[model samples]
Target chain A: MPLFFDLLGVFFFAVSGSLLAARRGFDIVGSFLLAGMTGFGGGIVRDLILGVVPTAFVNPFYFIPPAIATLLVYFVAPGVQRLVRPLLIFDAAGLALFCTSGTIKALEAGMNPFSATLLGVTSAVGGGLIRDVIANKTPSIFDPHDIYAVPAMMGSGLIAMLWMLGIRGWTWELGVTAVVFALRILSLKLDWRVPKAVGPWHHDTQLR
Target chain B: MPLFFDLLGVFFFAVSGSLLAARRGFDIVGSFLLAGMTGFGGGIVRDLILGVVPTAFVNPFYFIPPAIATLLVYFVAPGVQRLVRPLLIFDAAGLALFCTSGTIKALEAGMNPFSATLLGVTSAVGGGLIRDVIANKTPSIFDPHDIYAVPAMMGSGLIAMLWMLGIRGWTWELGVTAVVFALRILSLKLDWRVPKAVGPWHHDTQLR
Candidate 1:
C-alpha cells in the first residue's frame, strides 16, 4: 500500500515535470528527461547523501512509470491545461506523499530527526527547484509567496516527532500528510508570504 | 598556487553559467544561482560521494569567487560571448585539473581505483552536465560529436593506473592533463563524432 502511494506520487510529479517542460516549449526528449528528473532527482540526491544506491536507477518500474507519465502529458497536455487547477491539486497530493515518505525513509536509514526532516523537505522541493533553474526562473521555494518548502518541513518534523513518541501507524502518516496538504492549500488561498525588507538604492531596480 | 588555479577555474565557469542565464533573460537571483551551480556543483557531488562534506558550502572563498564571476558576467555578457572558444579552452583546462584532483581526493579518502576513476570523471564533467540541463540544452557529453566525457574518463583512468604503479609526480599529472586537453582540442578540430546507426525504417512523406 505504501509502495502504491509512492508510485502514484512519482507519476503525478512526472506529469507536473512534463507540463512544465511543455510550457517552456521543450522537445519530446527534453520533456521526458525533465519529467524523469522531477520524479527521481530528489530521491537520487537523498540516497547518494545517505550512501545508498538510488532506487530509481535500479528499479525498472520506477523508470517505466516516469516515461509513461511523460508520454501521457505529451499527448494530453492540450486537454490537461484546461484543468490546470485540478492537476495542481494532484501535484499537491504527490508532494504530501513524498514529504512523508522521505521522512520515514531517512529515519529508517538512521538519520537524526533534523537531518531526516531536511531530507524530507529536499525530497519534496528538489525537482521543482531543478525545473525552475532549467527554465531560467527564480525557484518558487525562494519566492516569498510560495509556501512549498515550509509545508514539507512542518509535516516531516511532525512525523519525526510522532515517530519518536512511538506513534507508528498509517493513521499517523495520513494525519501528517493532511496537515501539510492543508497548510499548503491555505497558504496559496490566503496569499501567505515571507517578510522582506526594501533593498539598498543600487539593488532596488533588480529586486523582484 | 593550486588554490589560485581552482579559484580561476571557478570564476571562469561561473561567468560562463551567468552568461548562459543572461542570454535566456533570467533575473539576477536566477543568474547567481546558475553560476554558483556551474562553478561548484561537480565538486560538491564528488565530495559527498566520497563521504566528505562539500567544501564549496563550507568555504566562504569558494562561494565568493562564483558570486564575483556572476557579477562580472551580468555586466559583460556581450563581450564574453565573443570569447566563447577561449573560455571553452579554459574550461577544459579546469576539467583536467579537477579530474586529477578529484581522483587523488577519492584515493586519499580510501576509495579503490575504479571508484576513484568514476569519481574523477564525475567531478570533471558533472558540473557541465548540470549546467546544460539547467540551460535546457542536451548535455554536451551525451552528444556523439562532443568528446567531453571521454577525455575526462581517459584522464581519470590514467591517473588511477599511474598511482597504482607508484608513479607519483607533477610530471605524470601534467602529462595526463595535457593528453586529455589535447584530445579534446583535436576532437574539436577534426569534427570527430561517434558513428550513428541507420534508421529502422526509411520513410518518405509517410506514404500509406
Candidate 2:
C-alpha cells in the first residue's frame, strides 16, 4: 500500500512536469529530464536532509514511474495535458502523502517536531519549487498566493502532534492525509490566495 | 590548510550570493538566506549523495562564514560590489579547491572515478546554480559561455586520476587547483564563450 501511494505520487508529479515541459515546448529529452526531476526532486531533498543517499538513484522502482510518465506524455502530449480533473485529484493525494511520509522520515532522522514538520512541507513542495526554478521562473510557492505548501504544513504539523502524543498508527496518517487532501481541494474550489506583502520595503529592500 | 581554504570558499560563495540578492532587491532576511544557501548548498548536496548529514547543520564553522558575509554585504553594498576583482580571484580558487575536495570525498564514498569527477563538478557549480535560480535567472554556467563547470570537471577528473594512480598528497591537489585556477583566469582574459546550441529549441530561452 505504501509503495502503491509512493508510485502514484511519482506518477502525478512526473505528469505535471511533463505537462509544464510540453507547454514550454521542450524537446523529448528535456521533457523526460524534467519529469524525472519533478518526480524525484522532493524525495531527494528529504533524504539528503535526513543524511541519506537519494532512493531514486539507489532503487530502480523509484525511477521507473517517472520514465514511464515522461514517455507517455511525450507520445500523447495534448491528451495528457487535458486530463486536468484526474490530475488534480492525484496531485492533491500526492501532496498529502508526501508531507506525511516526509515528516515521518525526518522524525526517524532525529529531527525535532518543528523541524520535521517544516521538512515535511519542504518534501511536499520542494520538487515543484526546483522544477519551476530550473524552468526559469520565480517559484510559485514563494509568491505567497499559493496554498500548496500551506496544506502540506498543516498536515505535517498534525502528524508531528500525533507522534508527540505517542499516537503512532496508520489511522492518524490517513486522517492527516485526508485533511490536507480536503484542504487542497477546497482551496482550489474556492480560489483561495494568500495576501501579498506591500510597501517600499518589499519594493526595493536595502540591507541597512 | 584544507579547512582554511574551505572557509574561504564558503565566504566567497556567500558574498557572491548576497551580491546577487542585493542586485535582485531582496530583503535583508532574503539576503542572509541566499548567502547561507550559496555557502552550504553544494556541500549539502555532496554530503547527501555521499550518504552523510549536511556538515553546515552539524558544524557551526560551515555556516558562520555565510552569516558574516551576509552582514558584511548588507552593510557595504557598493563597496563590496566594487571589490569584484579580488572576489573573482577568490571565487576561482574556491572553485578549484571545491572540485578537488568534492571529488576526493566522492572517491572516499566509494563512487567510481567517472561518477566522482562528475560529483566534483556538481559540488563546485551547484551552489551558484541554486543561487541563480532563486534569483530568478538562468544559471550562467548553463549558458555554455561560462567556463565555470568545465574547469571544475577538469580539476576533479585530474584528482580522480591522481587517486587511481596512487599519487595522493597535497602536491597533486595543489597542481589540480592550479590547473583550474589558471583555466578560469585565462578564460576571463581571452573572453572565451562556449558556442551556444543554436536550434529552434534554444530560441525562446530568455537571457540566452
Candidate 3:
C-alpha cells in the first residue's frame, strides 16, 4: 500500500515535470530526463541522506511513472494546460504523498522525530527544487510569492509527532496527507504567502 | 592520502562557494550553508548513488573546510577579489580532485567502468550545480560559455580506464587530476566553449 502511494506520488511529480518541459519547448529526451529527475530525485536525496540505496534505483517499476508521464505530455500537453492548474495540483499531490511516506520511512529507519521531519520535508521538496534549478528558474521554496514548503513542513512535523506518540496507523497517515493536500490547494487558491524577511536590509538590492 | 586530497578539494570548493555568497551579499548563515553545500554536496551525491553513507556525513573533519571558508570569505572577500580569478582557480581544483577521487571510489565499489566514469563526473559537478541552482544562476554545466563537465569526464574516464588496465597508482591519479585541472584552467583562460545546437530552430525562444 505504501509502495502504491509512493508510485502514485512519483507519477504526479513526473507529470508536473513533463508539463513544465513541454511549456519550455524541451526535446523528448529532455522531457524524459526532467520527468525522471522530478519523479525520483527526492527519494534519491532522502535515501542518500539515510545511508540507503534509493528504492527507485533497484526497482524497474519506478521508471514506469516518468515514462508514462513523458508520453502523456508528448501527446496531450496542449490540452492538459487547460485543466485546473494541472501543474500545481500534481505538484501538491506529489508533495502530500512524499511528505507522509518520507516521514514514515525515516521513522522506520530509526531517525529521531526532528530529523525525520526534516528529512521528510526534504523528500517532499527536493525534486521540485532540482527541477526548477536545472530549468534556470528561481526555486519555488525560496520564492516569496507562495506558501510551498510550509505545508510539507507541517505535514512532516505532524507525522513525526504522531510517530513519537505511537500512532503509526495508515489511517493517521492518510489523514495527514489529506490535511497537507487541503492546505496546499487552499493556499494556492487564496494566494496565501509567507512573509519575506523584515528589517532595513530587506529592500537592499545592491547584490545580484 | 586520499582523505587528505578529498579534504583539500572540499576546502577549495567551499572557498569558491563562499566567495560567490559573499559577492551575492548573503547573510553569514547563508554563506556557511552555501559553503557546506559546495564543499560536501558532490561527495554526498556520489556516495548516495553508490549506496553508502557519505564520508562527509560521518567524519567531523569534513565540516572544518566549510567553516574555514566561511570565515575567510567573511573577512577578506574584498582583498581576495584582487587575486587571479580566485573562484575559477578554486573551482577547477575542486573539479579535478573530485573527478579523480570519485572515480577511484566508484571503481573500488565494483561499479562498471562506464558507470564509474559517469558517477565521477557527477561528483565533480554536483556541488557547483547545487550551489548555482540555489543562487539562481544558470548552472555552469549547462552554460554555453565554457566547457566544464568535459574536463571532469576526461579525468574520470582516464581514471576508470587506468584502473581497468591495472595502473591504479597514486601517481596516475595525480596525473589525471593535473590534466583535468589544466584543461579547466586553460578552457577558462582561452574562452573555449562547446558548440550549441546547430539547427535553425535554435533561435526559438518562445518558451520561458
Task: Please name the candidate that would achieve the greatest TM-score relative to the true structure.
Answer: 3
Residue-level lDDT of model 1, residues B73-178, one tens digit each, is 5554444335456546656766777787788778778889999999999988877777777767677677767678788899999999999999977777878878
* TM-score of chain A by itself in each prediction: 0.87, 0.84, 0.93
Please report, as a value between 0 and 1, the fraction of native contacts recovered by candidate 3: 0.20
Tens digits of lDDT, candidate 3, A1-208: 9889999999989988877766655555556657878888899889888977677755657868987988777665555334338878998999999999999999999999999999999999998988887987678778776788999999999999989988889999999999999999898889898766765576586534
Stretches > 4 Å off in candidate 2: A1-40, A48-101, A111-121, A134-136, A141-208, B1-8, B28-37, B44-69, B79-93, B110-115, B133-138, B142-146, B161-167, B170-179, B182-186, B189-208
Error of 2 at B16 (Å): 2.5
How many clashes (backbone atoms < 3 Å, residues ≥3 apart in a chain or on different chains) does model 3 have? 0
Using TM-score as the measure, name the better of candidate 1 and candidate 2.
2
Q: After superposing candidate 1, which stretches have Cα over 4 Å from the reference?
A: A1-125, A130-208, B1-8, B80-87, B170-175, B193-208
Off by over 4 Å in 3: A1-39, A49-51, A55-126, A133-208, B26-33, B48-51, B67-84, B195-199, B204-207
What's the CA error at residue A36 for candidate 1, in Å?
Answer: 11
List of clashing residue pairs for candidate 1? none
Task: List RMSD in Å for every model shown.
Answer: 8.5, 7.5, 7.2
Residue A196, candidate 3: C-alpha displacement in angstroms: 16
Q: How accurate is candidate 1 locally (lDDT)?
A: 0.72
Scoring model 1 with DockQ, what do you get?
A: 0.07
